[model samples]
Target: MTSDISHVRSLTLDEALHENPVGWFQYRLLLMCGLAFMADALEVSLLSFLATCAGADWGLSTAQEASITSVVFGGIICGTMFWGVFADKYGRKMAYLAASTLITVGGILSGASPSYGWLIFFRSVAGFGIGGASVPFDLLAEFLPTSHRGQFLIYIEYFWTIGSMFVAGLAWATLSQQGWRFLA
Candidate 1:
């Protein structure tokens, strides 16, 4: 019993992560997470501002405009559920990569949409990708030192607010001057 006890080692996840000083890897993780939050904010808010412009350009009724805007939310709901499950089954990095691909492809297709139906479909695809944004916060928290964990998450969330503001400014500058396509 004494010999067996001497051979055993204990190195828990808490000890391994929390005992180390914050380093480049942690900082990179934070930056990546912050950027995901920013992209989510930008994509969500861009739809809201563009709704009015797109409606006018397409000569759509209020209901149609609302439907176009709301489809993204529906996509978000599905995406959140699907990606959440996928992340649990697989890994966060794989989920992030797949989601990011969906978002990029969706955005490009949305911009090239030749009809209202196509626009809705592509935006929904983009919304699905946006769902991946939820994973990073959890991933980032695990890597953060316990002492600063909560505060750092709060600070990282501010990137969403910044992203919202940025899109608003961008919309004002480009949407009005260059038209909706340029903004998209």
Candidate 2:
């Protein structure tokens, strides 16, 4: 009985290590997800910063600025509804990739926006990317085994928080150095 128990323990440890191999693929996947989370946080933070800039630069009233913020959130809601269903029908990898692409395009367009309306439109598009990313983010949690799922999900959240903080720091640095042009 003692020998049998030892053998079982060794086998379990070996299987655990093998299943969670440390390789370039896993690192790349983690980095990709981390970047997605960073983009998600950056978009929301940029919108908040843009509101103040827009209000001052474009002569927008408080109410109008608030509406701009609300529109971005509304876009996020629509995106979640649109992408979540499609991700369920398709696959998480593709959904994640598409979300990243949307985010990149939105960022570029927002930087080039010449008017308040244009900025708001691009902001909404970025919000859509964020919402789409969330679906696959949840799917990644489900993809892992029960034992490691919780740990990985928690790690993902930690990375997300890190990304948020990074964006906040960047905003502060950019604004301090160059002012509202940082929005562009």
Best by lDDT: 1
Indicate the residue-level lDDT of 21 in model 1. 85
Error of 1 at 64 (Å): 1.1
**Which residue ranges in model 2 land beyond 4 Å of their true spot?**
1-24
**Candidate 1 lDDT tens digits, 1-184:** 3355776677787777778888899889888888888887888888887677778899989988898779888888999999988988998878877887887788778778888888889889988999888888877887877886888798888999998999899988788787766655
lDDT of 2 by residue, 14-58 (tens): 366457745565456666776777677777767677678767878
